[model samples]
Target: MKISFLCILIAAIQPFLWAGAAKFGGQRSGTRYDNRAPRDTLAHLSGWPQRANWAQQNSFEAFPIFAAAVLMAYAAGVPAALIDFWAVCFIVARFAYFACYVANLATLRSLVWFAGVIACVRLMCAAI
Candidate 1:
């Protein structure tokens, strides 16, 4: 499979990773995960768990655009190396953004978000 295609899978899965962390990462702190009422559980989370939930939400928001960009680039006959490079950079930036969000590094998270956006924009431009 093309690396860009693989990145779509990774990007899809990334939000679940954050969701898992948000649900389970705070279990030891006396907040049991409410599987039946997951949204309620997430709503009460604070600190890292809360931030993890935010990260998960943002990941979901970002995925469609990234995936569309990759598909568009492939459809437009953009070079594999270029597509793969931006896709990988997007993945790396998202991971960094997640870490920064959980750690409360607001400024750094914004910078990383810009990097991810740039990757998606590059892919879109290449497709054009």
Candidate 2:
């Protein structure tokens, strides 16, 4: 498989890392996992834990666009190396985004999010 495809797999699992952070926080706080009202519980989380939940949501929101971009680029015969580079950029930006979110660096997080979006856009443009 191409490295870009591997990055897609990494992106697919990124949200789970953030979700695990949230769950870890809940465990630390002695809160039982409530399947029925999970969102309600997560909604009340504060600090890094709350940010982790938000990050997870953002990761989910970004996945489809990034995945589609990769697929489109491949289908349109974009060079594999170029696609791989941008895919790596997206992955790095996402990692930075997650770190910034957990650290409460709102401005930096937003910037990283923008970088990730740009990476996705570039990948799509390369295909066209």
Candidate with top TM-score is 1
Per-candidate Cα lDDT values, in order, are 0.94, 0.92
Give the runs in model 2 whose Cα sits over 4 Å from its true position: none
* Model 1 pairs in collision: none
| Candidate 1 stretches greater than 4 Å from native | none
Q: Positional deviation of 5 in candidate 2, in angstroms?
A: 0.8
Can you write out model 1's per-residue Cα lDDT over 26-120, one digit (the tens) per residue? 68556789889999989889889899999999999999999999999999999999999999999999999999999999999999999999999
lDDT of 2 by residue, 1-128 (tens): 28999999999999999988997887687766677998888887888888999999999999999999999999999988999999999999999999999999999999999999999999899888
